[model samples]
Target: MWDKERRSVATVFATHGAASGTFASRLPWLSDHLQLSAGKLGIALLMTSIGAITTMPFAGRAVARFGTGTVARTLICVNVAVLVAAAWMPSLLTLAACTIVMGAVAGTSDMAMNAQGILVEKRLGRSIMSGLHGTWSTGVLVAAMAGSLAAHQHIDARVHFAIAAAVLAVAVTWGTRSFRTTAADVGLAAEKKEDVPLFVIPRGVILLIGLVGFCGIYAEVASQDWSSVYMHRVLHGDEAEAAFTTGMFAFTMAAGRLSGDAVVGRLGAATTVRACGVLGALGGILVIAARSPLPAVAGFMLIGIGVSVVVPLAFAAAGHAGPNPTMGVAGVATIAYGAGMAAPGIIGGVADLTSLRVAFCAVAVLAGMVALGGGLLGRNAPAALHGAEPVRVAEAEVLATEG
Candidate 1:
């Protein structure tokens, strides 16, 4: 059982994370191939967000109906196919259409995988979400490294995407096959008795978590979409070297998340997230000010490290937000990812209206929101869910035993 759960956690993260890396690293090239202006590019990107938002409401129900393992395995393959197809899309219209389907396919599968990770975390009775999330960062890191080298070598986008699809497909297939039986597969029979919305706007405590999650997602997606463009266009970086921006960001993000469990254990979620917010802000500022590619790389790395654990913490909170972890996760994902995707549209408009640096200033403000949003978890109710307890409680139990 333990082994199966471990495999579920690892493979589920790999499928989407790797694909995200592939897409992000290749986005500038995709845009160039389509001959898109900044505004047109934003519109294209918005279509993907639209598809994801529409599909997320069904995420909870799918996990309840089909089981997380099956859902994750099936949709992950679909996501890979979309990436492959995207490389060959001939027109802006076709790529926009492809992104919509791609977003929907990837979003639902990611939701299921997250559900699986939560279930496993519950059984282990420790904080594994951060580590599971770290695996996702590792996937992104690997994809970015591969894609960077490919782009630097002037590899055709279609050939590059095809190679990535084949690699991820094999790894995901093998990984999913190793899955252990999970509670998600067992069923949500009793959970059906309660009234739950297919999609919700998150209220009260959960709303705060969702907003912070939004900030995290906003920073991440905005960076993914624009950071490379910023370097290539603004700093006059070599097209090949521009690919390294996403790679650098993903590398630091993976590094931070891989070590996140230890940091969270020591500082707890609230304090840890606050620190990350600070890092994100500083990183954004550095990127805005840096005149050269190397400095921009350093800035991106800082942003990566700072924003690394925000979503993991948000997902951890969402997992315990209500009786049905799936519903809560779905609700928060709706708010965060939905809003996160929307920001880039406005940013694209702004970029067209002014400059990319100005658009990124908007991103820095969102990062500040992450810092301020950390206070919402001040009550630390979620900590109890992860099995944290006071030292005094242990002392009391010991003294009672002595008595």
Candidate 2:
């Protein structure tokens, strides 16, 4: 069985996932309610990316000052409230405003939870970050399916979102009760003295590791945005077939994440990430050359598995890479999340100029970059620097007793 702190953090991750998934699954209904065109809806959705990108640079400072638990609990409530408000928006302008707040809360909470996960992993003296992320993906899958069913039954968006908000709020309250409330509480007081910039930016080894994760995020976002389009337009697949390919990518990505920790333990983080990058690159090649829907589906699934653990592993690496884990994480995430926002435009623009196939060449090259930068995630620094040195037995005992 999982320990209290670990399970609690996992619940936080799950609820956050559900909150994000709810918006995506119910987007069509929101679009219909607002009477939005494809262009208008696209613009409204872009507000979310803008909000998240702008807010992420400051997330580390928030965590450093307030502690992960406080930041997470506060933001989870704010994020849920924002999502519920979005369900009631009477105009595109109102909904777009809600989305910006929704995105900022969601992104910052994401950073806080992962910071907590790093602490949990350190306490346990093992690799649990991947498993924590796997639970997040699972939460998304479950929530997406439920939202889809609610929409199919013509349930009111207000009712659905309200119910979701109430449930998540209650769950988060219970789950965060065990969270350690300060850096000193977790034996990380020394890390607080390290210089963390007011604005997060990748520098030194952190930049290199962030670049590796950036490639993975770029590929992941590109596939999520384009796999269905590629299936329908390129292979002339029917709607069901196109949806199936997209489903395949999502399913394999989730499955691979669930199993990633064990794989990391066996092969080590560097080798596993390197291999995953190679696999993603191969998958990209197959997608570019694929003439049939079947091949495209296979390729997308490969891409899914290939990129599944990259972000989790990257977060783990960044957590200990500098004197301040929170700022190190913020810096890496700024770069990596930028890739997520950029992938769609870059790929779409390239496809417009040439072809989608040619555009994916960028993804393939980025995947290869993951392999090249994989070595940067090698072993941690010394204990004095908050590296991956084994947690003192006494410190672990103190944590358990305090909980």
Candidate 3:
């Protein structure tokens, strides 16, 4: 059972990783094919983010009704189809439509997988969530490398996407059989009833954690989406160098997450979180103040390391807070993702009004706040107030006995 569960989680991670990789590789092709100006491209990308925000809450509900596995498989299929269509389509309207559809599917998959991970962590009786997320980072690494290779070989975006889709299809096939049904876990239902509020409101510690997550995700998104542009436009880097900047950030992030569990185990969540926040803030400051490309790239790497564990830690904290951890996680995730979508555009708008350098400096200020907020969160410890019955142990025992 454990093996099956492990494999199932791994498959989902791989699918997401591959898709992200393929998407990054295909962006240049997308730009060239559509002849999109930077402004137009930004607008189109914003639509995709809007689709994600619009669909994620609904996806959480779907996971509540249908099973995580069902939703995951369905969304993967949809993602593949939409991505393929988007790859082939040359028209801006068609591309926008396809990108929105892909975003919706991706959002659904994201919710379902995390909900599933929550369940899996309950069963395994230890911290597997970070490792699962690490797998996602690993997947992105592989995908980026693979996509770059394909591009270098002159493979068209359509062919690359088709290949990625094939890989996802195989993974989905293997994962579905081991997928847990909602009916399989009565305890989770009871817990949900107990933990979830009648009115969905973010308050107390959960709200604090969500805000922290918001800052972490905002920093991450900024680096992922804009670092390359910054390198190219501000630092006068070539396309290859710009791409390398993004890749290095992702690589370091993956490394941090892969090792995050150990750090958490050694330092405990409170201390680990505070330390990471400080590191991230410092990294952001360094990046903003950097005069040359090398320093900027180094700053991004530091940012990656600092922000790496924030999301997983936040999710774990959220799950531990409420009896119905899925609801808690979903709520926090919704806020965090919404923040992520808004970060780039907000930063871009600020950049347009002022300068890109100033915009990044603003981000640094926010990152410092995030770090301090994380420390404040540690001091308050709302996870304790949610009725400290050793939730992790109780949840694990329930899974073991139920299974």
Candidate 4:
């Protein structure tokens, strides 16, 4: 049963990852095919992000009522349908509209899968969230590679998305049955009959955690959506080199998450987060200040490594923060995601007004703030505050008996 559940979780992660990769990979082609100027493309892309933010809160409700399997399957189908529409659209406006729909589906799928992952982690009683996220990164890498290969072979973007959709469809079909039928409560409520609070406004510690996530996500989204363009246009790197920068970011992020559990266990979440934030800040600064493309690319790698563990740690903190873990998790995630969605447009506007390099420097400042915030947060919460009273108690008893 455990094996089956793990497999299902892995499948969902992979499917969502592939979908994200396909969307990202198709963007360059979409821009060229539609003859979109950079500013116009930026505005159009904002619609997709708006769609995601608008839909994510509702996705939480859907998961509460319909179950993760149903939500995942339905959203996956909707995503494919939207991709098809996007592929066939003749005008930039039409494509932008399709992008909005695609974003909605993608956002819903992300929430459902994350909710499912949290549940699975509870049942297994260990740290699986980072690993599940790593799988998503793996899928993104695979799709990016596939898209690159197909483009090199002179394959059309539509065909590439279609094939990617087919892969996701198969994954959804196979993993549908193993998804949890009931939502898993992570000791959030005292009674089984109590439904998880769907609309609690996060306060106190939850709010702080959400802010941490907001900063981290803002940095990450900026990198994901703009780093390639920055590399190509600002650094004068070739197409492949530009793509490699994004790939390197993704790769380092995945590597960080894959190894995060051990690091978190050894260093503790507070210390680890502080370190990551500092590293990310340094990386962002490096990207902004680098003289050559190689250093800029290396900066991306540093940012990836630094920001990798922030989200998972934030999520874990949210889960452990309040009595209703789901609501807390949802609140933080929703805020973080909303912030993430807005970041690109904000940065794009900044670039329009100033320069891309200056805009990235601003992002570096934000990343530095995040690091400072993490340190402050760590001081307030500490390891003793992470709901680990029993460990303290056990240690106390051992000391007393030994004495």
TM-score to native of every candidate shown: 0.91, 0.82, 0.85, 0.86
Which segments of candidate 3 are over 4 A away from where they belong?
A: 183-203, 375-403
- Model 1 gets an lDDT of 0.77
RMSD of each: 5.2, 4.1, 4.0, 5.9
Error of 1 at 314 (Å): 0.5
How would you encode candidate 1's per-residue C-alpha lDDT over 210-309 as one tens digit per residue?
8889999899888876777778878888666777888888888888888887787778777878898899999999988988888888988888888888
Model 3 root-mean-square deviation: 4.0
- List model 3 lDDT by residue over 1-403, tens digit each: 5567777877787687667656754565576678865445555566667777777656545776677788888888788777777888767777778877777787678767777776766554456666777777777667766665666677887988888888877877677667774423634544333333433455777777888888888888777667766776678876556656777777877888888766665666666666777777777888888889999989888888878877777777776676656666667766776556666666667766776787777567666666676653344323322223223545566557556
- Tens-place lDDT per residue, model 2, 92-111, is 89988997787688778888
Per-model CA lDDT versus the true structure: 0.77, 0.75, 0.69, 0.70
Report the lDDT of model 1 for residue 41. 81
lDDT of 4 at 177: 74
lDDT-wise, the better of 1 and 4 is 1
What's the best-to-worst order under TM-score? 1, 4, 3, 2
* Better structure of 2 and 4 per lDDT: 2
State the weakest 10-residue window (summed lDDT) of model 4.
Answer: 384-393
By lDDT, the best candidate is: 1
lDDT of 2 at 104: 81
**Displacement of the residue 251 alpha carbon in candidate 2, Å:** 2.7
